[model samples]
Target: MSNITWSFADRVVAITGSAIGMGEGAVETFAAAGASVYGLDVDAKRGRAVAERTGSTFVECDVTSSAAVLAAFEQIATRHQRLDVLINNAGGFWEQNTTESISEIEWDHVIDLNLKGVFLCARHAIPLLRQSSAGRIITISSLAGQTAIYQSSPAYAAAKAGVLSLTRVLASELGADGITSNAIAPSAVLTERIKVVRSAEERAATAASIPLGRYGGVDDLVTWMMFLASEEGGYMTGETIAVNGGRFMS
Candidate 1:
């Protein structure tokens, strides 16, 4: 993907939301890098297929459920005593509603998936991470969380913002154990879900708005993830990297 090369040999990596999009890409990337990879998702069929194609293990897990998350980690612990990296990559919102227009169910689903899921995974992953010399928690946040350039789901935005906060707290709490926690906030990555949500005209308009003059590819984000999970990224923690192609610069 990027010019930078990484070697994850002997590393044990676990990825959430591995059925599609960024999570799927992370599974493939890490596995190719020689890491023992495990892909977790609610979509058992697609998840199993991805694992088979990439030579990684697959675990059917609903991240929103504590019991499911615990069982998934238990399986990982049984297979590998420690975890090197945990990629929290499962989150999405179907509805783009205003604060008042959003329903309770919609809000809870978005918040639970985007925010609560991160918390649960981090909570469970900490023990395994502590067992590793260089443990990492790399979360996939969103540009919408930082700011709303367009109309978007209120719950999704709020939940993503919450992820940023949680990432920092995890970093602070786990830094003593030599574990680093960080996040990536990406914008306008043209995944299958994005393509379905935005029409051609809307996509073009978004591209024109970005200084980069195009939507981001999966590689762009995956490459950042690689860096965050590498030895070179060991010193950095409690920070969020914004990879939005100059769309929102702070």
Candidate 2:
């Protein structure tokens, strides 16, 4: 986040869950790089604020709804005609619980938002992405996807694992079309949701355990995303880059 410079002058980038947290960070990052950024989220108020700050387009879209996703892409296509990058950053953890304690409703809710949402966005954006010369699809996963090294809802872990599989599948299927798909698995990032869910003492303890001596931040994830979307990342596909500061290595 220092002396960083990357120019994506005419690239069109779309980010899900762009209202806050890592998604918002991405919007700001791409906008600064001169990309035509589009922010998608169900929270219109916050999304609009992000758009105002970054000068990106804000679209009200619920990632879980196929119709909403389709309409949003239609709007993007109408404006940009082509999409260079798609970041599936919209995800959530329903609650902290084990299999026996987790309800079927909770499982479905978590899976739908975290995993299904990624599928829906990719499904709609593939056509637009194919129109670009260097298309990049970056999905935000979690260290929980690799191993059970952190305390998270069982549903969260399962959904993120599914995301990793989906990313690889997309890379394999879309490679012939000159598209690249990748996943970023981060651990203990300090986003708005994390600040609300974990206490200060808990966060300090978690940071102490990390080999980097601090928890990851939104900028760290965004920087990786920028690289994956850059021309230098053209040859990369079906890879999962871990950004946990050595919390879990696989």
Candidate 3:
């Protein structure tokens, strides 16, 4: 039998969007498994509180801004000396009356936060991640990244699609550096924002659509993340694990 214990005893993991929901859960889980976790979020209060509770570090960061992302990465180096994992989970939805009604500013914000933020964070975190013996970059894509779904807006869909593309490119490009890039495409999950957006009936309808007959929880996604971040996942790169409860399968 395999001893599937995820112990990052001397490892550092930097998770963006780590203030709440999936990010917050991951912080707690990873920390419990012996990882030195660091969180980056625009919401400093929630971020710091979560970090304190989990014994992780929190850094105030607006992922959409390159200046903030770079500064956060610099601080990570100073504190932990090296970084092992980068979870690019910062994203949001934006649209106007329709695709036609979307302003240039609106379009930019969605793309910047969803797509550009991942690029910026990975770019800045690369130096430190590369220093680790087994470096992993895990980006959070969605069912929107895989196929057209009515859940997210147009810009969010496009940016998440770009995240998948970036994952493949980086995996190939960074292979020699011993750095692996992968993505997780999660289906509808019952998170705080999701609870507000989806009613009980609507959620039931969506869950019924999945072959698994349920929504994939945060833990479902975290299990894959833990796998990809582990040393055993060295050869498993450039892949996107879908945690949609078989919502849309290939």
In candidate 3, position 248 carries an lDDT of 84
Worst 10 residues of 3 by lDDT: 94-103
Candidate 2, residues 188-216, lDDT tens digits: the string is: 89988889889999999999999998989
lDDT of each: 0.92, 0.93, 0.87
Mind giving the per-residue lDDT tens digits that candidate 3 earns over 55-101? 99999999988899989999989987789999998787844235766
Question: Which pairs of residues collide in model 2?
Answer: none
User: Candidate 3 local accuracy as lDDT?
Assistant: 0.87
lDDT measured at residue 229 in model 1 versus the true structure, 0 to 100? 95
Clashes of 1: 0
lDDT of model 1 at position 173: 96
Q: Give the alpha carbon lDDT tens digit for every residue of 1-250 in model 1.
A: 3444699999999999999988998888899899999998999999999999999999999999999999999998998989999999999897889988999999999999999999999999999999998999999999988998556899999999999999999999999999999999998898888888799999999999999999988889999999999988999998999999898987
Q: Considering lDDT, where higher is better, how would the candidates rank from best to worst?
A: 2, 1, 3
What's the CA error at residue 204 for candidate 3, in Å? 1.1
Q: Which stretches of candidate 1 lie over 4 Å from their true place?
A: 1-4
Model 2 scores a TM of 0.98
Residue 46 alpha-carbon offset, candidate 3, angstroms: 1.1
